[model samples]
Target: MQRVRVSSQQAAVHKLGDSQMTLSPKFRLPAARSTITDHALDFDNSLTGEPLIPGFPDDVALQCLLRVPVDQHTSCKSVCKRWYSLFGSKERFFTLRKVLGFHDPWLFVFAYHKCTGKIEWKVLDLTHLSWHTIPAMPCKDKVCPQGFRCVSIPHEGALFVCGGVVSDVDCPLNLVLKYEARKNRWTVMKKMVTARSFFASGVINGMIYVAGGNSTDLYELDSCEMMDPKNGSWSPVSNMRTHMASYDSAVLDGKFLVTEGWFWPFYVVPRGQIYDPMTDNWENMPAGLREGWTGSSVVIHGNLFVVTEHERTKLKVYDSGNDCWEVVEGPPLPENICKPFRVNCWESRVYVVGRNLHVAVGYVVENYEIATGGNGKKGGRFCVRWETVDAPGSLFDLTPSSAQVLFA
Candidate 1:
């Protein structure tokens, strides 16, 4: 990749492979043949049209504009329609913006688009209350099965989205999709251990573990498997006893915690159970969640936060060490989130995104606080404010309940 900087004008041209990209006042982008012509457009509408907002070097101004959040950049577009026009066309600004990384304190969300009936993906920057669309992967194989929910696993510098579909009645897709930010592309990875949807998956160390989801026949998986990205193969890890069909799992205290979600009983048996990978055994955590709490659940600060349509004014928090359920104070969701759905936790926050009648809604993303009030004693209160963001594309079952990545 050869990069050339032309000093004749305000902006510099980046030469990569055979493509030449122009920057500054007016961007004279290279043609399809990777050829650059003298013809160019000026940002300033002057006689000669030197440049708009001069004095600052073109390179510096480009960098600053790129620094602004992409979601907020939409507002910048309204400031000057010309500036908005530069977004999709200019190559320099796009290249620089992608590299900056959306490492803001936020939760990325993906919902099943009822209008198109395809999955709609987005990321929410909790701090800024912004939304950006993430492009979906090109499912060339058409083998990518759909599960009920989507999960995102951040690997290397790319986020891997996999699993889930409303109707996996036929050939379910167990394959995973990896999205690269720099390239702005999605590539299909290896398949998961089993063909099931509505299950939970978490990432620990260098492996991805998915547990307990119904198959095409609506048969729930009893065992969990681990995937080594290096080998692109699945290996046996442990089996969960409860056979929870729609439960959530997270890595807590260096071990995985699977909670909430539910199972259909044959003889009226309790459907929920919690499992610890270290011990390879499922233990009944707290008694309150026995009825099967749905929605989304997350494990933060050694406590479990479960939200559902069943309960809105309060959030259920379970103490891992003591194995006790504590009611925490929190605001009710936007009313749409109380229905059955999947929840994801990232950076001490919980996000719930689900669908009803194929229409997606809920707390696209929000921060969570843990109030310590259990056993007639005031424990402690911890809160984290979060803003929503749109991941680049529609993702399925990226990361299970408790498994999440925090950029601090």
Candidate 2:
């Protein structure tokens, strides 16, 4: 692929081959079961002591302070030294955010309207079930010209968009954009190491990873790289074992799973590959995992759930413990949704926004072990429910290219 500058002000694009780091491949795959440590408990149990704010008593102060939303933590921190100490512990702060029911799921949908030849971002406040227009992306003509893949920083309520093709270019895009929900604005970030489209992406342990997509000349790339938000820079990583055009990605048990979206001749594709950032290695996935992951995939409570086919598709859960897939149902849903829709998993809750402006919110209530399922292979069973909400208005007829979830 030909290298191009992102812009005069953007960082120079880097390639995997340009770095001195060895691009070695190890075939070892981690256990299908993830061994990554769970997040630290979000709450501090020792908050019954003396008050940090001086005037208030400990118990009384705790009640009043917990009411403050997570987004306002920065300002609350500036109140005094003690407030910073209390809010500085991210785990405890998030725990409070969750415990007090302050964390609300926010959804972002990227729509490129061919009718007007423009791209606009719409954000839905799921808690209140309403939509708000966000700042326009910088990519001119058709933003995310080919198709955009969105990754979210739920804790910080920020979003990143990558991949997609531009109207004027023969190749896809390496341009990346960041959306800060607090400010409801979009800004260009460091360009990707490689220009590609339809790549696999996800956020694991807060790092953004992109792998396998269409490079120049219709080449399906086997390469991959990652971006560290802390430093606002990109670094090359080892490539995947196979050239995969990742259509769907999910983070389960601390590992990023990528599916080989499609293949020529026979349509059958395997379960795909799983990358363990801890070991910096990629391993082939177990067979049959791909079929279950046909469309959207999300992880809830350390368990994997996927929706294949269309809007009304039955939800399937992968029970890593039993090594079997299970069907789950909780709420009834419309038989079909707009052909182009999105499923986003935030804090285990799934939000589907699409067609154009329609939205559906869902959650998995429970999982059950099935006597038999999955092409005669016995699978587990689960329950899920989804309800649709009418968005404010339909700005265009264009389908949503990508969607993400955050809490703000």
Candidate 3:
């Protein structure tokens, strides 16, 4: 049997025997700086003195530390230099979590205050059912929600907030900011080649891609670019067939799909485009797919699902074989989860955040059934169970613009 001391001041001890190890109830590390930016400039990374936990091998200690809840990491890092080195470095802490297959999905919502118009980010820990506030984005200029696009590389536990318009001036920006979940820090990354807003952005093969958005002069841009996050550099990609701005976009089956969405006047069909990284080219989206795309889209289990924009929001799944969308069997979007909601999914759950930060979780059933519509068209049918999570009263004035899921 081995005994490990977690904290000397607290005199907390955990016994490691043949069975699994559990931390002592009193084992609490000292509190540290809440935000990385507070001490990032003066922080030291040199490891010295003791192992992560005294009286245990470093490797064995790591397994015990890995079990710490992510929310407690800030406090745990303050215990010692060795512990800080383990949790402070993304390549060390986050990469190990991925290797060990300890993924806890957290939803990051980018929202703005309705009265003040100040933008901020809030994270929902799906596992613990709690909320955490991250460091403010490092943008010098005031910006509005929906103008910038947020995308994440889930496995790496990183999120990128790309170009957006200035709140007061409406001028587009090329700025990009990255937030590392494990470090609880934000780092501004290399700017995009072109300043853009309301652009289409997504991750393909671990690379970031942006295309067809409004420029500084408010003209729709036909330009596109790709960035390799490893080096924080951007390269030009083939332009779209026509200058277009995305109303909705999704990465499905490793391909990037962008649709302008149907505009009013009811007769003119919206234009859509598809980007294939392998071909380094763009193609027109199929008429059936683009015309029927009426709302926000999320890809789950390799299938495209959309929450319609109409008065009574309904969930619909795309049928690639039939090239059309069929409404899935599920409860209508919760009355409380009102319009202008942002949607994102992880595994089989579809998360929708509506006005005032209210959330609706929809679980999609895997075994789909074949059903015939009134038009006698065959379509796949799946069932969804809906549940709602209310936002804290303090955030009642906030409205979400975008949401992304990251695993840590």
Candidate 4:
């Protein structure tokens, strides 16, 4: 570092004997008379440390910043003003967001660079298309279990991820991994009672519901459990009448709706069942769904809507009062692209995300359109369009190749 000096009285510093350090009359001190007086004794200089730098090449310095995991990256910016400026810049901040959004919208995706054996996590921000990586967890194995699946359920402001099989064959896992958005780190939670994979889990009424898993015998589990995040305990619920293995469940109208799973060893269940936790019972909703009924069910606009992957699947709105399914018309995409669309209710609208190909390379997002027919009616056709990648679209763009729907 270069050293510079100046007189204590001046605010600016200068090198010794530099032209700017000339001592003229302007620098002259006041002359003292020959009279002496009693003086007070005091010598204190406690406040002395490093000075703050006001400016830095933020854009340039930021280039040196490797994307750290989300949990620890914030501290890197907090180290100093220069670092803070570089990391918190609008561009860099947004870039981190995009990374998190694409990695796994639901905060489920974990990445391991086998070469370095570094494990990291990417969390998606649904509102704003962005990415956030979690700090490295203690368990650093590069391999995740072959059939591991992660689910994130929002509690308060944080998201709790639970029940994934560990990579180690000797010690297969039923451990719960939690990612706190405010803290930005992954903390291991209490393990589950049963070890399983490919199950359906979600939060409903301050409790997490986990059900249906593929067991060692290739048979699906009919059992279900409820987890209380507050108490850190689990309890059993009424098991399904039949095995709904590898099924999807959604909470609507104070009831849990499970749909589209293999009823038999190989055939898919065309029936829909509604489970009421309040009543501790399950009621068969109806027999069959429209053909190609792949999308998850959702309750929206004071009604329940069953959307199909294709436009032809149409909109089947259920009237709870009348006990019936009504079809609404609209523009729809190809059925193959999203036979089983992942449906989510955000804000006041219902959104659907589906991949264009079976390989799951590309995806699209669209809003369900509602229309009115004759006599100024309130209902008619419902339609959806593809969401562009550059814009908020079907795929959560984490990096160039990997993508998923935004969830955070």
Best by TM-score: 3
List ranges where model 3 is wrong by over 4 Å.
Answer: 3-101, 264-267, 368-379
lDDT of 1 at 176: 76
lDDT of 4 by residue, 93-129 (tens): 4333333332323423443333443445544444343
TM-scores vs. true structure, each candidate: 0.63, 0.69, 0.78, 0.56
**Candidate 4, backbone clash total:** 20
Q: Write the per-residue lDDT of candidate 3 for residues 377-396, one digit (tens) a residue.
A: 43346767789999889879
Candidate 1, which ten residues in sequence have the lowest lDDT sum? Answer: 357-366
Q: Report clashes for each candidate as comma-separated counts.
A: 37, 11, 0, 20
Query: Which sections of candidate 1 miss by over 4 Å?
Result: 1-53, 58-60, 71-102, 140-149, 154-157, 165-170, 242-244, 260-269, 272-295, 334-342, 352-408
User: Residue 279: error of model 3 in Å?
Assistant: 1.5
Better of 3 and 4 by lDDT: 3
Model 2 RMSD in Å is 16.6
Top of the candidates by lDDT? 3
Candidate 1 per-residue lDDT over residues 1-408, each given as its tens digit: 122444577765643221233233444433433222121222222222223236754444554565566566656766554456545432434444443443534344444443444554555545554556557765532222345334444434446665655342344557677655445567777887677766766667666777787776666777787777676687777678666665555565656656544444324544565666567666664555554344456665555576644555245665545555554443555443324444665545566554331112222122232232233543334333223233333333232221223231
Q: What are the candidates' C-alpha RMSDs?
A: 9.0, 16.6, 9.0, 13.8
TM-score, cand. 1 vs. native: 0.63
